[model samples]
Target: MLSSYLTLAAILFCIGLYGTLAKRNAIIVLLSLELMLNAVNLNLIAFSKYGAIPSLTGQLFSIFTITVAAAEAAIAVAILIALFRARGTVLVDAFNRMRR
Candidate 1:
């Protein structure tokens, strides 16, 4: 069961990686990042439940990760909005070629 959980998490993370790499839209990339983060949280929580620890360290770490992820998302969204305003498109290639 633990193995299965870990496998699922790995699959989710991989899917997120592909999404992040294959998508050109800023919002889609952001969503993929969130998906990857959730995969990590799942692994942490699962380890916390199954592993022999004096305290719920994995759970605590997962909480910390979640907090950090929220901050990252906020910053990323702001940057995306700025990019959209300046470049008129969120596609990675468009942003890359942008110049005066």
Candidate 2:
């Protein structure tokens, strides 16, 4: 069951990665980011539940990751909104001017 959970997490992570890479919309990318974060949380929770309980490190890491993901989502959404306002479009290709 633990291995299954990890496998599922890996599949979800890959799907999210593909979505983030293949989509042109920033909102979709944000959603994909959330999905990837969820996959990590799943892995953390699984390991915490099945591998170790006395230390609680996995759980702590999960909580920390959750906190960071929330903050990242807020910042990313705000930046996406700003980009939309400035460009009037959320297409990834259109944001190429951001490239170094």
Candidate 3:
């Protein structure tokens, strides 16, 4: 059971990583980041449930991760909105010109 959960989490993480690295859209990138975070959370929960010590530490950490992910999403969305307003585009490649 633990192995299955870990396998699923691994698959999810890979998909999220691919989406984050390959997507052109900022929104999709942010969503992919969230997906990656969720995969981490899933792993944490699974370990918490299956570990020999059997404490709540993993779950507690997962909760904290979720809180951080929520805050990150909110901040990312705000930045994306501002960026879109300024440039009329949400493509990652377009952001490169901002360095100049």
Candidate 4:
């Protein structure tokens, strides 16, 4: 069961990584990043459930990770919105310049 969970997480992480690296849209990239984070959370939960001397530490860490991911998404979206307003585009490649 743990192996299955780990396999699934690995697949998700790979897909997320590909999206992050291959997509041109900033939104897609952000979504991919979230997916990757979720995979990490899954692995943590799986290990917590299956590891010797199973404990809640992994779950606690997963919760913390989720909180951080939420904050990151909110801030990233805000920044992307501002950038779109200024640059009229959300392409990751077009964001090379930090300032006009």
Q: Give the range of the ten consecutive residues with the poorest summed lDDT in model 4.
A: 91-100
lDDT of each: 0.90, 0.91, 0.96, 0.97
What TM-score against the true fold does each predicted structure earn?
0.92, 0.90, 0.95, 0.94
lDDT of 4 by residue, 1-100 (tens): 8899999999999999999999999999999999999999999999999977689999999999999999999999999999999999999899888676
Give lDDT: candidate 1, residue 67.
100
Model 1: residues with Cα > 4 Å off, grouped in runs: 52-54, 97-100
Tell me the lDDT of model 4 at 99: 72
Ranking by lDDT: 4, 3, 2, 1
**By lDDT, is 2 or 4 better?**
4
Candidate 2 or 1, higher TM-score: 1
Q: Cα deviation of 73 in candidate 4 (Å)? A: 0.2
lDDT of 1 by residue, 4-93 (tens): 888999999999999999998889999999999999999999888876663589889999999999999999999999988998888976
Error of 3 at 60 (Å): 0.9
Q: What does the lDDT read for residue 41 in candidate 4? A: 99
Query: What are the per-model C-alpha RMSD values against the true structure?
Result: 2.1, 1.7, 1.1, 1.7
Name the best candidate (by TM-score). Answer: 3
Candidate 4, residue 88: lDDT? 98
Clash number by candidate, in order:
0, 0, 0, 0
User: Where is model 4 more than 4 Å wrong at Cα?
Assistant: 98-100
TM-score, predicted candidate 4 vs. hidden true structure: 0.94
